[model samples]
Structures are given as structure tokens and as C-alpha cells.
Target: MSAPVLVFGWGNPSRGDDALGPLFVEAVEAMKLPGIECLTDFQLQVEHALDLRRRSRILFVDASGTARPPFEFQPIAAARDDSFTTHSVSPQSVLQVFEDLEGRPAPPSWLLAIRGDSWELGTAPAPSANANLRAAIAAFTAWLPDL
Candidate 1:
């Protein structure tokens, strides 16, 4: 059986601030929280829909260049948006694929977008981005108890 909650974080670790997503997953994994599973990827793909099965709640974490300072957390739903692709997709696109495969709506989901200012390849994550990541992780940890 799968965990009741799924936390999927995606981003390229080689890219400066883009590494926030995977870093978030790493932190969560270290927490060793029970009943929650964590996964990380360089980017979201259609295949991730399979991971959504048997999950009660899903949290998609990503580093966003346009997000507000610290972070942004908001509910999301399955939608046939332009972001759908086999190589790279959005959280909503993944949810849509899950629904398409299951013939029903996907589990409730939310996106936790951490603010990122730098994304250059082969560069270290920016201090500001790391700070934002810390804040986002703390918020998620607090929210998990109510899940």
C-alpha cells in the first residue's frame, strides 16, 4: 500500500535555485515522518501520474522564478493545460493524467512554489533561495499534522 500523503518535489539540482525542489525533498526525507512518502525528480513527467494512485493528498514542490518572495502555496486541480508533456509537465497536468488513467478525479493536491532568483547551470543555490526553501519546508511541516 502507498502512503496516505505524497510529497513530490521536482527540479534540476545542477541549476542554481532550481535545486530548491530536490533540496526540499531531501529535508523531508531526513525528517523521517511516518505515513508520508517523498519523491524527487529533475522535472515532472507524465509517468508521475502512477505515483498519484492510492494517495489521499499530494503536495507538489517546485522553485518558481515568479513566485512571491518567500513562497506560495495554493490548491490545484487537474486541467488540460499546455504544460502537459511526456518530458515535462505541471502538477495540474500530472493530476489530469492520473484522472485520465483512473477514470476519476485525482487526490486533492497543492503546489508549494518557493521563490528563486537564480537558475544558472552549474551554480550553487543562492542564499536567498535557500532561505525561501527553509521557510517553505517549515510551513509544510506545520501543515502536515492537519492532513
Candidate 2:
């Protein structure tokens, strides 16, 4: 059976802080927790909507230059947006696609936006970004048990 919770993270690992998404997924994978399926990609695509199937909850992680420091977690809902026309879509857009394809609402979802400042290609993740990542992981772990 598919895991009831899906953690989908996406970012370009080659980019500095942009690696936060995949790095977050890596950390979660190491935890080896039950009932959680982890997925990482360079970016979110329309096809990712299929991953929502059979999931009771979903978490979309990404490095955000605009998010508050450490991270921010907030509930999301299906919404039709301009992102649908782009190759890289947002979490809400993916939820909208899932709803469109299934003719039903998607599983409850949230965005775990990790704050990131740098995005230079080929450089390693910034030390500050890594620190924020650690904090995000801690917060996520604590909140997960209540779910």
C-alpha cells in the first residue's frame, strides 16, 4: 500500500541554497519513519500530481528566498493559478491539477518553505541555510507526531 503521508521536496541541488528542498528530503529519509514516503526532484512538474493519490496528507518542501527564517508551514488548498502554465508549478497548483484529474479534492496539504538566501550555481549550500534546515527539520519532526 502507498504510504499515507507523502513528502515531496524539489530544488536544484547544484544551486547553493536551492538545494534545501532535496536536502530536507534526504534528512527525512534518514529518519526511516513509518507511513511516510519521501520524494525529491529538481523541480515540481504537473506529473507530480499523481503522487497525491491515496495519500492522507502531503508536505511540499522548497527553499524560498521569501519565506521567514528557518521555515514556515501553512495549510494549502487546490487553486488554479498561472503556475499551471509553467514547467515548474507550485504546491497549490499541483493540488489543483490533482483535483482536476481525479474530480475530487486532493489530500490535505501544506508547504514547508525553508528560508534561503543564496542560489548561485555550483556552490555548496550556505552554512546559514544549513542551520535553517536543521531548525526546519526539528520543527517538522515535532509537529509530525501530532499528525
Q: What stretches of model 1 exceed 4 Å from their correct place?
A: none
Which consecutive 10 residues in model 1 have the weakest lDDT in total?
A: 81-90
Per-residue lDDT for 71 in model 1?
99
Candidate 1: clashing pairs of residues: none
What would the per-residue lDDT of candidate 1 be over residues 62-91, giving only the tens digit for each residue?
Answer: 999999989999999999988873567889
What lDDT, from 0 to 1, does candidate 2 have? Answer: 0.94
Per-residue lDDT tens digits for candidate 2, residues 1-147, read: 789999999999999999999999999999999999999999888899999999999999999999989889899999989997887798999999999999999999999999999999999889999999999999889979777
What number of clashing residue pairs does each candidate have, in the order they appear? 0, 0
lDDT of 2 at 145: 78
Error at 136, model 1, angstroms = 0.5
Candidate 2: C-alpha RMSD after superposition: 0.7
| C-alpha lDDT values of all predictions | 0.93, 0.94
TM-score of each: 0.96, 0.98
